[model samples]
Target: MKTLGVIAGREMRLALRNRSILITAAIFAIWFPVMSAFGVVAGAGGDAATIAGGIAAITIPVGIFMGYIFCADAFLREKRDGTIETLLCTPVSLRRLWEGKAIGVAVPAYVMTLISATVTIAAISTIAGITVVTEPLLLLHLATIVPVWIVASAGLIGAAQLALGMRENQILGFLLIFGFIFIIIGLQEVAPGGPGISPVTEGILAVAGIALVAFARFTAGRVTRERIVLTIP
Candidate 1:
């Protein structure tokens, strides 16, 4: 447990050193809420649910992009730079390393997600002067979104790096992710609406996220450059 915490702490510090991560955090913490409020005001006449839905719509994409930034290199960078070998040679088991890294990536995303959600919700309440109830369902949705985003972001990013890093075709991986996001947006339009729907959607997100985590784990444990190239071709 101590070893895992140390690993997680190290990754967290490295993420802090990255300017892009800081910039993204600032955007989510401050800019996103202000922009969401403006968008809601500009769109006008919608009920709070509709406005909230709109906010979620915008948030989902930004969330995915943020996920990419936060997670796309959870393991690939280490392997690329030969740090993985050093870590693997340490006393830490693969499971601990994976768990530690997962926590390292997810923790920041969770914090930033909460910050962004709070900012957006507060801004919306202030501007619309709407008596917003932070009801159980609303709270549930907020709670679920953070973990969902973390898993989805970590899984997708980790999988992409493992799958595409060999070809040095990272742009293709990003494009594919955006394509998936567009599909998700389109699907949301077709789905039946309400708070009840959030749980179901989150369940689906969790499934995909777990798959990615599994893939990351498997890749880290077993896959090699030769295997990656063979699989890609």
Candidate 2:
């Protein structure tokens, strides 16, 4: 437990040192709401709810991007640099290392989203004034999206590392992330009133995304003939 926490903190520090994470979070933090506000003010876009919804839409891809960048690096960097083996030489277990790496990546991505979302919400609330009202339940529902993205990304990146060996896995992560958002949009458009409209849908999408990533990672882990046979037994 202590080791995982220490590893997690180290990961967080490493992420903070990286400029891309900061830049990505900052750009979206400023970009989405500003664009939404401009559209609202100029009669060019949507009301507050629409603006909020648009912001939510942007968040899905942004979440994926953050997850891919952070989690992919977390899962692959150790293997690529040979640090993972060195860590294994210590008393720390593989599961701890994996969980710690996931935490390291997830903590930053989650925090960045919280910051970005807060800024977006604040900006929208201030500018639009009384034009649009936000429901508490809606805000709560939206807040859950960040953690979901984090878990999904961790699973995807881990799987990519195990399955594609990192080198060939890059494009798939990007595609999967965007592809997810596209699917979400398409589903919403086609079946807005479908049974998939509940919080259950949210749970399913999140679980499915993370589960797919896990499957990829697990598949990679069991690629060896010995491991495959062991599972069968």
Candidate 3:
């Protein structure tokens, strides 16, 4: 646990120090929520469900974006610089290292998710002149499903970055960014009626998020030092 904490702390510090990345992430985290809030108010008149849906639409993607940007520094940069090889020589196992790094990235990403949610709620409240109170299910989604998805994404991306060559990571990164763009566009299309967050839908999302996390953990476990080293370059 101590080792994990140390590793997580180190990654957090590294992430913070990268001012360009930090600024870019901050912009996305703030901008998307504010825009989504406006669109919700304009189209849906800021009903609770609409506000919740708007916030939900932006929050998950912002969290994923944060994880995507940070994972490059947390996972790939280390490999590229050959620092990861030295870390691999330590007593800590690869899985723990992956967990620590994923947690580190996910923490900040989740914070950004919270920020996006807050911004959305505040914008909706202001624009529609009504207090924003989300549904219980939406609250549950923010508290549980969102964070799990962020962790899952970071863990899975980190595992892939560690296991793949530089060329592959670059290609994967491009695909991830474009995939996020498409997801946001798709959400925009469905967001007009607001997401029908029935209990069943919530359950399915929760289950899917948990399964993704488990899959990421399994992928990380399969990553060996030799594979990581061989892939480096």
Clashing residue pairs, backbone N/CA/C < 3 A, model 3: none
lDDT score for candidate 3 against the true structure: 0.80
Give each model's whole-structure lDDT. 0.62, 0.61, 0.80
Full candidate order by TM-score, most accurate first: 3, 1, 2
The digit string of per-residue lDDT tens for model 2 on 1-233 reads 99989988898888888787578767875676566555544442445545545455555556666667787557666666656556766787655666677778877777766666666566666766633335443464456755766656665565555445444666777677777678666644554444222454455555655665566456445444232222221
Better of 2 and 3 by TM-score: 3
lDDT of 2: 0.61
Tell me which of candidates 2 and 3 scores higher on lDDT: 3
- Model 3, 139-188: lDDT tens digits are 88789878987898899889999999999998997676566547444544
- Per-residue lDDT for 1-233 in model 1, tens only? 99989988987788778787778677766787787687775674546655655555555555556556666456567756656666766788766776677677776666776677677778877888864345443555556654665655565455556445556646755775676577556556555563223545555545554665566566556645444443342
- Model 1 gets an lDDT of 0.62
- Model 2, poorest ten-residue lDDT window? 224-233
Which of the numbered candidates is closest to the native, going by highest TM-score?
A: 3
Cα-based lDDT at residue 160, candidate 3: 90
Regions of model 2 farther than 4 Å from truth: 36-48, 130-134, 194-233
Q: Candidate 2 — which pairs collide?
A: 159-217
